[model samples]
Target: MTMGFNESQSAFAAALLDPGLPLPQGITTARGVTDPLRFAVYRNNVYVGLTTALGQRFPVTKRLVGSEFFAGMARTYAADHKPATPLIIHYGDDFPDFIAAFPPAASLAYLPDVARIEVAWTRAYHAADRLPLDVAKIAAVPPERIAEMSLVPHPSAGLVRSDFPAGTIWSAHQGEAVAPVTEWRAEAVLVVRPAMHVEIRFLPPGDAAFAACLLEGTTLGTAAQKAFAAAPDFDFGSALIGLVGLGAFSAFEAFEGKLP
Candidate 1:
């Protein structure tokens, strides 16, 4: 009997998921017979392709888990969560959450946060480009008006906070030899794509607070005030220079004005 549209789609999904399953109805085989082997080959190819794509998206997660474990997790993740978009580059948005609840990786509590950082890095690399705010413009603003002026964060800016030293772990794996001590303290990371490359930096608590406030549209003066509250020794001058050098500020305008 000819399968209906829904039935045909169901059959195709089943065949793709389980290579041992028979071919979907209305599909042909080379030998003019229902050859499960041919369909199995096709199913395996699909899995392989998806697995490779996931690996590329989460290379750090894969490396931390090792080849065998990474492959196994990738298989389970792929099966449960199929891509909604045809663009492979946009895949793996749910991977960080997947790693968090994955039974096999339950022991590595920091794995998910590390994955988040990697994902942010990838996203920043593809974010919209904009010319950094001119330093002269910022300097031109009157001291009296600076308190009401808001700074805009770059399009590619992202902040990550983790209980574990995710940035340290990620950096260590990338060829730096560092101790893997579990301090159980919060570490903040700032990611910005100033030019062609993505730059990752570990942010001090005060600086992170300041940056977060600025990103939320707070005036520069307000952000600095908050930073000083967080850390009495907060160095506004140094932090501003560092942020501007990293291209964190795309533009500045009056607090009520639209970002330029």
Candidate 2:
């Protein structure tokens, strides 16, 4: 019934994350040092390594705030949120919300959204790969039945909505900015990795709604109608073509039946 730890795994893990606490009961150094200070080396190494890993995962967040500030903030965050999984690449998914609440970063209200965009990018990059949908097959479907078809979104497709123009902020970091924008605007972002690269695009209002529906398994006709209801000027043709260009879908099949 026992597993990896000589003592309790919980006790060992707690001491690793909490440097102030005494070393776990069964641990010992070669010199037989009894003081908690004996465990300081392991504590420092674990904390430093995890903080560095988080900084790598949230490069934009680090850039958004200065490195020193980010490091300090990262320490505060890592204290409470221990790594739940062995994979560090996907760690810090909640750092955005942590930033939103961190008092020093509160003035920069958009920091959380920017972090979310970064998370989306990392997730898309690691998502499973699949060949792009065949546009010709979709084109051959009868016009009337096309509405009843449902799209199978690629594994890497994602959507992010923010009250701030996070896409523009992210772009500014990529050296694509000519000048800083003064006015604030709401934006919706599409995150996808069609091939080798992960892309972030500012999604049109209707497209986000329509794509949301498709991703949720709604019929294409119902999705488009709902999108049009949200934005009367929604353009189905352009959206479809653009998504196909991005290779956002893997297949298009009838919502409830096989194609003839």
Candidate 3:
């Protein structure tokens, strides 16, 4: 049957990533013959390119599972999940969730969270550049008005809270030899590109809660209270200063007071 340009394009795209689908209608070589062997070669290259992109984006996840294993798994994913955007960098945004449900990776429960951190890191790297809020502005706020103020999270800021020690595992993979994750407790991580480089920080549960609240536009007082509730020993003053230093906030918003 004859197909329009859009229909032809859709068929070609669907068949490109899926080997089971036959070649689109009217597709022929220079000799005007439909060659399944030649088409298969082109299809293989597409899958290989996609698998390589996934490997680059999720290096730690690739390392956790050996190269061969990763290649096989990545190929499986590439077959089922085609890139929605032309930009390869954004191709694997949902890869973490895919890993979570992948039967081969079920034994490594932390693998999904580790992939999540990698995804967050990639996003932080590509986020729009924004000048971080100056630390002095936050400090100059009147103590009484602190409760009414909310800090604006930077465009590059991301939080990853994991039930496993995923942050520790990710950090350990940064070196040549993977360091042993001695502590297996739940971990929360802050991924932000506040300056020239992206910073990956492992945060305490309280600090993570506080950052999450602030990122959601919660008032400073409420965020602090939540932090305290999460961990009684939460240090409000130090955490506030630490986040500021990390450039987590790009600006501040006051409900009823003027800016400093």
The candidate scoring highest on TM-score is 3
lDDT (CA) per prediction:
0.83, 0.83, 0.92
Q: Rank the candidates by TM-score, best first.
A: 3, 2, 1
Of the two candidates 2 and 3, the one with more favorable TM-score, higher being better, is: 3
Model 3 stretches with alpha carbons more than 4 Å out = 255-260
lDDT of 2 by residue, 53-164 (tens): 8888888778878899999999988888898899988788888889989999999998999999888889899999888787777778889897888888889888878899
Weakest ten-residue segment in model 1 by summed lDDT: 175-184
Flag clash pairs in model 1: none
**TM-score of each candidate structure, all chains considered together:** 0.82, 0.89, 0.94
- Name the candidate that leads on lDDT: 3
Error (Å) of candidate 3 at residue 49 is 0.5
**Model 3 — TM-score against the truth?**
0.94
lDDT of 2 at 260: 57
Residue lDDT tens for model 3, 1-260: 79999999999999998888998998999999999889999999999899999999999999999999999989989888999899999989999999999999999999999999999999999999999988888788888888888998899999999999999999899999978988899999999999889999988988999999999999889999999999999999888888888988898888865466
Candidate 1 per-residue lDDT over residues 13-87, each given as its tens digit? 877976556678877776677776777788888888888998998888888889999999988887867778888
Per-structure clash totals for the candidates: 0, 0, 0
The TM-score measured for candidate 1 stands at 0.82
Looking at model 3, which ten-residue stretch has the lowest summed lDDT? 251-260
